[model samples]
Target chain A: MPRTNRQWSLARTPRGRLTTDDLALVESPIPQIGPNEILVRNTWLSIDPSIRIRLSSTTPLGYLPPIRPGEPLVGLALGTVIDTRNPDFAVGDLVSHIFGFRDYAVIGTRADTIGGYGLPTRIDTRGMPPQWYLGPLGSSGLTAYAALTEVLQLRQEDTVWVSAAAGGVGAIAAQIAKLRGATVLGSAGRADKVEFLRQELGIAAFDYHDPTLHESLAELAPDGIDAYFDNVGGDHLAAAMDNLRPRGRIAVCGAVSGYDGAPHSGNPDLFQIVSKELRIQGFRAGSYNHLEGSMRQEVGGYLTAGDMVYHETIFDDLTQAPTALLAMLAGKTIGKTLCRLTSE
Target chain B: MPRTNRQWSLARTPRGRLTTDDLALVESPIPQIGPNEILVRNTWLSIDPSIRIRLSSTTPLGYLPPIRPGEPLVGLALGTVIDTRNPDFAVGDLVSHIFGFRDYAVIGTRADTIGGYGLPTRIDTRGMPPQWYLGPLGSSGLTAYAALTEVLQLRQEDTVWVSAAAGGVGAIAAQIAKLRGATVLGSAGRADKVEFLRQELGIAAFDYHDPTLHESLAELAPDGIDAYFDNVGGDHLAAAMDNLRPRGRIAVCGAVSGYDGAPHSGNPDLFQIVSKELRIQGFRAGSYNHLEGSMRQEVGGYLTAGDMVYHETIFDDLTQAPTALLAMLAGKTIGKTLCRLTSE
Candidate 1:
């Protein structure tokens, strides 16, 4: 074999809606493996809302450089190594990387480092699906763990209200809070998600498309809410402010509602925060890099003991990647949406 | 001499504006003092914005009960004892009690107690004006202290931004932060207040009526702010969110901006909180009742050493009480406003 490769590159800057034509699939010479480099045959790719932020000139994160046009779109993916020069990784082993949107990736030991480390390892998936690495057992899992347990210091007996409860991060967070013995309540867009949260996840209460969400929450937790895990910002955050009890805590994780539109203009009733004596904090999972070991241990144990459950919406082929991404952005997909690049 | 007593009672509830006619002064027969009661001649009464909340049925604090149609309006006051049946208090002793807006009060031994004990022997005026006991060394002072030092855990080297810098709590909070070696910047309403904060209080920087407050704050704090003491909570809060550094802390103390009007609507850019990893907390002075001894000690020492300064616009008599309160609510007063009932 002459070592063939295929990669997708950004074709142009997107103004409003991005189309498949905006990404160009190109045939390129396979990269040569250097000392401390590993060549991976990409198997799966994760599409997230954070990618939309990277696509534009504005990022609320305010730290990373803006993505330029005519460059490769960078994101997370799972792959198996076909060739390796790095001593830490074997040729037959699997790995995850901050890989570009490509069919194959050549990852160096020092390349794609963020918060001062390379990508995570791909341990035995056992009988579990490989796509689980992109959902609950991966970045989304770490995000839920860090925000709930570390940043918010969630108590087992506390009442938790989560927004976007059907999305990847929100779904896992609600389950984790329930597993921790919390009274969990979640909000989603459709009736199916509401039923999923109530019947499948054993959530204490669930609401969908309720215009009186604030009043509904008040009625549900008449004694008042102890903590809120916010994924959808804007109106949801404002409602959380009103429903929070004295000394309530909020962990701000994501803001999918306003990501594609003009920023929300109304100021929250901050007076409630003052009079009720609440605490609101923001967190990113990347900041908790050291906790990866503990998180993996705990979450892995939970999965093995049947205390945790997860769902995934899989797109069969790489050609459907654009549709999957669009569905995820529109919040039409349930749980974690993944694009399967190759058959097992 | 025959004993005579005069009491002021609420005659009617004002629809929009309150006047002296709303309160009626009537002479009453002096009742016999009970076994656990002490009769005191009201000397000084402290009027505050919190009193306004108690006047309405929809108060958020839920502390004082709503005033009855024809009952005496009660508040925090300083007085002198003329007769005592309680063993803990003696005649001729000066005391602070939760009974005011009247000429005399039959304070129960259980009612006039401080720290579960009877009132202290004497108040130390210490070259500072006696009115300060109602402003800086009083409940308002404790509120600012508790929120900034305890709840917010403000650092000595932190850059602090304060809103309503010329008002009672804000003026004292700004000075306190400066004393703790923090770089203090503040926002007030008028040019005179800006000058007062800069020249009189020695604040590092200040702005008045700046249409571009957000831009001005960004320029002042190029590195970003470490902590904020929020008093005026609408746009000021949004501006603070934009300028906060990572891991920044905000102590929400009051929301005078939205106090009298309908609650302001709209989703503020709370996503900034998540991206910056900020911590925002609300605090009440009552929560830190354990710190009363230490807080008074420190504030009293500062006053005695001439390190802290305060101002009060005094209304001459009980008839002018409503006007003084309206002045404070309208932002007409420079600092704390109180009503003096007697020369003694």
Candidate 2:
């Protein structure tokens, strides 16, 4: 006899507003493992705004495939393996996989099994909580790492400005730039988040909703900024353009500010790019899957040495997953938002 | 005894239209040559749009001191050496120097001459007209070369888009990209200029005042543009962004479209830069002073071999210099707008 499993499936396509009815809790029979497959009991599920694009029928960028109706909402998640047929992965070993929004999943053992970097599996969450793997030391941390190191090639003497500084990716990117001896400045929506960046992360400076954002930045960085890690677009980018030094680099990691609206309107004045010689680049974390080994080793060392810190907004049940995602979309959550499945 | 010489001095600042009264023709004694200096009779004076910046009290970006009222307006000009005290330069030799708008000039003989790029005192106008040195094989050609070769890193298989296609820099840059094996496309304001680009340069495609500029470009380059040499900014940049491939490179050479207007209103939408991962870089031809020797050899050889061609809208007398500049500012000139001091 096999065990039963519960998974969240996309019930319908979202038109305007997403409702709980868009997702349905369904029962599924436990899948049998193949010779190279492993059975994982997922403990945590990550909810990200990028999932909204996957839910749409068509996207302008055309990066990822659209999710089908009645199919599991697939994304990145943290899980622990209970059974494995592959010789490399032993039973009881904790792992992270690109599995679905399901409690238990039977995934084929491939080179991408460990950190998705084709590296050997060596996951040891010693004193820190396992959930940190999905937030800072995981996909979000890698995004910040690749955007700063590979894309922007940030220098030690450079000044870095990060938008959406309280979010999962921005928070880690600011800290990483700080760790590399850069003067770090950040922007957040609320006063508390601004205070959090200064008081908690020891960020050099932070601001919230200043109407003269460009002038404020010019005052802060009299010499001008060397690089910008943009998570929130729109006015933040416009302000950044005014403050960027000649030959400055901008890493376009996300545009959460105008994700729901048309991208044409509310764009920044780009004529300065000609006079200033600015470089704006967009990057997805998956494109850097090859660097996951060294990235994990470096970020994991930072975690163990108490050099990096991360926060998670946790939801208790799977049914609350929709609400958690909505909160993130509405900018109501402070950090990485995840749902903990109790029935696993 | 040396003859008395006349020079054009900046008399007053212009709010809109510039008049001959704005410049005063004053007579002064011809200058005496120093140990490292040479005396030359000015033969041809070059008039460019960049001179407008010198007339303003505030200097433009990447430029030196503004032209003070009551001082002579200065720029690059070709002349015949009448006397020389330096061993490197000889009498009766034709030379180019950054002399004031005067009939005779005394310039110091440094390794690099009066031209900002410190070019050597060698002459190589074999078979081609000497005036061609003032346009294509001079600063204009060097600007196009540096922006395309260094900044954009123009690749052979790329699709290149050049704005202001009939202007001095744009016309040459389009040819250079085409020579590098790129599929070249361009935009000109007038139908005649558009036909000139199509018939004369053999560009892949062209457009003129089309409201559907973005759609037209998308249709022309279905695979997306790989590089953009921007001479005109504003809506052209926005259209380029719409058609740029992921990781496309842009050389921001000039913003002639919005140079006369305020910054924000005439600027293009820059938010697409994030999605496209565009590298928009500004370059001053003066920055690549070291490459002048090799660039002159290369571009000069192309001109001599009949592999390259250029057109100039020549004004007959020194008095017409101001009108010629005004015509260039109004986008009325087809090719390089130059003032021929006297008939050859």
Candidate 3:
């Protein structure tokens, strides 16, 4: 058992692009578990793009507040309960919580669940891989499910476009949309990712960097798409608006194009929204935690039936978590970006 | 009556700012009504902002096609039937149709209703001012009513903000929203229009030019607004997004800011939409023609009970239709902009 805990903390608010020097991995004495508190040895951390928003000097309105310098970064992680004063949780139980980017976390029963990274919950992996909970059977899966079902109300006959279709939530969205029989067109920044979406995911895909985004989208969906699953904003969102059919629906899950110190491309011809009577809705995963059980059931079934393709770009240990995030944001990672803290 | 019919035609596709030189009123012989056709001597013409979009070389997708040079312009008009070859219509009957910017119209049975401008329908004015059919009781009224009821689903607890609040649709939307028991705030560009909204319309109003739009909106609605009725897009839309509370709703009726030659102001922090979980729906009055009866019942009741304030900026004679459009687009008009062609 480790006697000390090492956690990643923000050394400064990043100005443009983030760097390793901006993050500090500091070792400290393991925290003591108080009454009703649980000590968790975090084994896996989920590296997501939304955290980049919090690293700025001020986060967007209604979002989680910015993480100040020297504050440990918070994220979703899977851990084993090493010690527990809480009656409900037992030692050796694998749990999921929002105290990640660290080797150990001290959790309380009454921890805040504002972003739906709720209190630690025990996972019943059901003989499946435990890391799957951090990917398709967890927040990523729920985001895709809620967006397609609740927001988009995707119909089988509809043709839908998914931007950044090689990313975590988007990949799941593309597959689930196809499983429900919608014609899916996926777009990615890189040629390799576009190939993956075409050959591996079996979805009509395009490289957004080729020619013009409008022309690329036009080629894939000559009749215009019925719905759009937006993971990249800026030019991608503008293209979707231009190519969407009348009365089209758009589900905005993320706007990663502007997350890495780049200004969001504006002038999206908002008149398109009025002219086409388009409906745009922006959502986050925390709001859809209610659908987690059903997501796990359906997605887990897909995994068991070999009908789903789950991919991961995982770093070896906690020290590489920052590298994993930079790689993912740079569009180098293939699928869900994860940091494996232990070989357990 | 008159043997010659004076009709407004597009002289050229507008380059930037629309000028009187862009429009030419040409006199032509009145056409005879054919079988299943009715001849209407237009009495009042509604000069709306949407016409500016048609004057451009190309319109937004799903919108009415652009009117080319030498083509007569079209709009909503109130007229009296002078001759009828159809059994359903009788001479001297009052009618409303989409054949404005002209002194006379020959309406056929199969006229397209793509934008919900159906074939000519006789309007029973019920002793109300017949011109009211073009203002509070017509397309403008229906637009406000549908936005509040259908898209916003306005609640009594909602604090709603209406942009371009002194314009035809915005004024109606602001009043209707207030009548539905919601706290309403209005914004206009000019001081007099702001005064009209505040003192005459009895709503909390602000001048968008005073201070920054965000500061002005924040001064009016400090906590946050629950709903936004957007008529002028660009900065107003961005401000609303910035000031909307979580789960806020925005009903986009028009984007007049972009309809003119000026480019739409962009870089609205779209992340705010996701953080606040905002739902934005763009709609047109044509889509909500079904609610006309209910709108007439409610708004007509308000006007009859002396609880509604209806104002008009009238341009005399058919020649002033171009001036009326320019004034309306430049925010020089208060309430509905109209061209009164006849004394009757």
Candidate 4:
């Protein structure tokens, strides 16, 4: 092991747009672990736009702890156990934890060293890409899965629409709703993303830039949607509200459109809420933390059966995480953005 | 019984504000009843903001059939059965039904005379003011009761806020939430209305015109609220979203703010719907139609026990329905607005 661990610490809390200057890469003495400890060497780190909510001084509501300044940022990452003093963990065991954003981390007894989300869990690659553990079998995928079953309570007859359809959580949400025997519709920003949604995911997908989303949605689902899984907020949400049928359900799992500290735009036609008897609610991935085991198993089964697919855009090293996150916040990334610490 | 039935029919759907000119007072010979029929002489008629939705040519999205031009405008009213051939009804039985805005209605065989909701059920006044049935035990009361118990799911420790707290549904909603052991707060438009909310309803109340609702909400519920029952949907809704805690619930029963047919103004602060993990869903009183019996029983129990109270603003005679409805929608009336057709 090297004498130092390289990590990105919050240089200054961001204002408006997130820039690379918001984070500072620094060298620190390798953390020393106590009894019942394991050391991890991170291989891949996930960069999600939700991380921006934490970078703000006023923590976004819900249950997640705020990201503090002058501290290493926390995120999901797949890693290898390099050393262990704990009987529960063995050297060379593949694992995943919120101990990412650093090349190496000490796992126990030091308050800042270990992951807040319990112990690092062993990862089963299932002969698929290991990075899938950070996606389809991880927090983002669990979010889509739990939201469909618990929040939306999607039925086989439901006609569902997914906004931000090509994004990580939206991709899984669109696919899962389809697998549940729903008639699915999806909206993506770019033509290629719309193509990916239609060709790969096999859903009727449209680009949001073409005219108004409300008109396209009316043409696509003439009867109206039974449910909506919203990843992008604003006008896409407003359009869905306008078209949602009576007793419709919405699982607002993400609001990537408002992550830039901008006030939420688009005055939604809310009168339809009463007139249509619609139910719109917001939920966080962490709320489904207990169902992760079942979510992972179910989502993993579909991935192996070829009924599901996912995409990843990789940053070569941890140093590029800030840049990757910025690209995602700017709506440039089509799918999951990952920081690859080491090559396969 | 009178030889002629006088009713208020729609003249032309008003484009903006509803005026008496939009309604035509006409007389038709009372129709003869069929084998299974009843004739009702209306004594009271309800004037609700929701009535405006029906008068529009473009039907509001829910299941309620739109009011046709040149047809008697439909509403809820208390009446006495003047004649009956059906075993289900008896002559002179006090009843309530959605067969109002008229005097002398031939209620069987003809589709237009009978209430679209259902047959007139005999009113069980429970010894309180008989008119309390329309305010606290009728649809307005049902709206508040079901919204608190089923929609908001009020817990013992919850802090609740009721918008339009002096209005029909809002008045009952404020009382019911308080009975459920939740600390209650309300917002009304006028000083007198605010005083009514505080003294008569016995809840912490504020005037909406007081500089900013958001600041007042923060001051009222410093820790944040667990539930909100909204009758007004503009800035009041925006303020509620700003103050609700995580896992908060909202039951959007009415949007009186948009009753004027004006474009919905004041863009609501909706990002909090995501940040707060809020569940904001819209519902109608009729959606809880089946639960009316239980709601009546529960609400009646409170009224009899003096644990709950209600108010009514009466407009005498059917001719004043248009005037009454216009007044209620204009925010002039507090509590239930009823047009009295006859003395008990």
**Segments of candidate 1 deviating more than 4 angstroms:** A1-39, A61-65, A81-93, A106-133, A262-267, B1-38, B61-74, B84-87, B106-131, B261-267
Tell me the TM-score of chain B in each candidate: 0.86, 0.89, 0.98, 0.94
**lDDT: worst 10-residue window of model 3 chain B:** B111-120
**Winner of 1 and 2 under TM-score:** 1
Order of models, best TM-score first: 3, 4, 1, 2
Compared with the true structure, what per-residue lDDT tens digits does model 3 show for residues A7-70? 9999999999988888999999998999999999998899999889889999888888899999
Highest DockQ, which number? 3
Candidate number that wins on lDDT, 2 or 3: 3
Model 1 agreement with the true structure over A99-132: per-residue lDDT tens digits: 7477788888663555432664755787666767
Predicted candidate 2 versus true structure: per-residue lDDT over A176-201, tens digit per residue: 89988999988887777787788878
Q: Candidate 2: deviation at residue A317, Å?
A: 3.1
Clashing pairs in 2: A277-B282
Q: Which is the leading candidate under lDDT?
A: 3
**TM-score winner:** 3
- The first chain of model 3 has a TM-score of 0.98
Between prediction 2 and prediction 4, the one with superior DockQ is 4
> How far is each candidate from the true structure, as Cα RMSD in Å?
4.0, 4.5, 1.8, 3.0
Instruction: Assess each prediction's global lDDT (C-alpha) against the native.
Output: 0.75, 0.74, 0.90, 0.83
lDDT winner between 2 and 4, please give it.
4
Whole-structure CA lDDT of model 4: 0.83
